[model samples]
Target: MLTEDFIGRVVIVLVVTVLTTFGAIHLFVTFQQETSASSLAVVTRTGTIAFMVLQLVMTVWRLPPKGTARGIESRVTSVAGTFLILVAAFLIPAVDSETVQVTALCLIFVGTVSSFFCLYWLGRSFSIMATARKLVTSGPYSIVRHPLYVCEAIFVSGVIISHFSALMVALGVLQFLLQYRRAKNEEAILRQTFPEYHAYERTTPMLIPSLSSLDWR
Candidate 1:
């Protein structure tokens, strides 16, 4: 007898695994074609590939949710916030500015590296939807309650910059709003599961890191 939760986990793992494999193949083909690519391009591709692999592993082994946001709104916002940039990328035409491309690459690299650390700290607590597995209040979470979202925003900003257009700008704004809503949904679940989360929330910034919180030592 297979429960819905087990089936859902299996599906999620399979989907992510497939996507990561395909993305790696695409990157490999691109690298082969552009043998003279810059060092940043090479480093970004490597980091991106590593991130995908780590995500796939984490998806397979993540802890079961202690609480999940109920209602269609939570589900819709989570899914939309996660994939909006990919949708925009597929629809928009990328710009041809060398300088902007370089900047975008730098941003993507930083976002990828930052996200990897966030995910590392998150460990088995990671999920695409608003669910509470464990309260992670250390590391990057100490700086911002939703460090993952901040890193994602950085990544998405780079993607939008590469595909700079009026429509993409609009979509980027929408994406940020959706991510905010998604974070709130996650916070609701976390607070419900852990009473101490309220204290953490009071002390920590939501998306933006507070300058005053830094020790600077």
Candidate 2:
């Protein structure tokens, strides 16, 4: 059922997962010199639960119909999004010490707001399983073709900036690249899916929305 691209990406995902996991373990152990492993484990479990719940909700609502597989780029973006969410959720709280207190809180607040907005805007349009859904070219889509992805980047950026670690930084940059690639492919598909999408694309920026672009009518 899986295409070569998907298979290839799955391999990449596995490798990245292992590396990130190792990095996370090392990070914990290194910092465990200062903090308690039990507390960190609690943080990791809590983050995993929260992220999994959010992912479940998104998946149920936004999954595309059967046979509508998005390309490698989109899938990669999805994977990156998942990775960053777990990384931020699990590690950020653990690393939140006196030196990074303000940074961590600010990042969490901003990222949470942005991610919520993304989820709200995506509504029933957020699916990994792939299913048929109406091309959402209004509301947030009217402002930007891919508001959800923009929100995703914003979320990752907030978390990375808050933590300011090598691993988070690497993940954030990779996520941004993947999201951009995915957005491009998604826009191409959108152009075909919606009768009015070309017109919508002409008026709307991809992500950096401006007030003047809105019709407000």
Candidate 3:
């Protein structure tokens, strides 16, 4: 008989796989229709699609948690932090400025590429919730303990900038708080599971990279 964890993993993987497939198809169709799209737009859309696919693949193959957060609060915060900013992006009307659009695209592209590398470093250790699979402390992780969140802030900043509304700003602030909380929750789990996590925490900055401790390897 399949355990609850196995069933949950299957459901999560299936949901992500379906969402990725549809999202990729929609992006492809939009690209095809926009015959005169800018080069930046092309690159951004392609990178976004690639990121989605890669994320789906990673979710399907991600490691089982060594320990998970005990309560519903951690799960809710994790989900909201991961997805609420996206709601603002889709709901708010973007500014009608070519310069702003270009800047937004550049930020999005850079964030996407950087996030791809972070995900690569994370590999199977990635989790949507506050679960400790493995402690990764290399690559971008060496720069900051929560490099993925930093990349996400970059991406979401672009979105919020493009849609410069009061509501978007509010949502962005809320998302940031949720992400911070989620990071803390993850740290708690990691600290509980791994003895070395305390040393790593002491050495690494939470979100921002320290210029002194920049380690690429």
Best by lDDT: 3
Q: Candidate 2: lDDT of 119?
A: 71
What would the per-residue lDDT of candidate 1 be over residues 97-179, giving only the tens digit for each residue? Answer: 66666787778778887898899899999987788899998888888888888897888787777668999999999999999
Q: List the residue pairs that clash in candidate 3.
A: none
Question: What lDDT, from 0 to 1, does candidate 2 have?
Answer: 0.56
Instruction: Give residue 32's error in model 1 in angstroms.
Output: 8.5
The TM-score that candidate 3 achieves is 0.83
> Per-candidate TM vs. native?
0.82, 0.66, 0.83
Error of 1 at 146 (Å): 0.5
What is candidate 1's TM-score against the reference? 0.82
Q: Please, what are the lDDT tens digits per residue for candidate 3 over residues 75-189?
A: 8898788767654453455555557768878787778878888998999999888889999999889889999989888887876766678998899899999999999999999
Q: Which regions of candidate 1 are displaced past 4 Å?
A: 17-53, 215-217
Best-performing candidate as measured by TM-score: 3
Q: What C-alpha RMSD separates each model from the true structure?
A: 3.2, 5.8, 2.9
Deviation of model 1 at 104, angstroms: 0.5
- TM-score, candidate number 2: 0.66
Q: Which of 2 and 3 is ahead in TM-score?
A: 3
User: Candidate 3 vs. truth: CA RMSD?
Assistant: 2.9
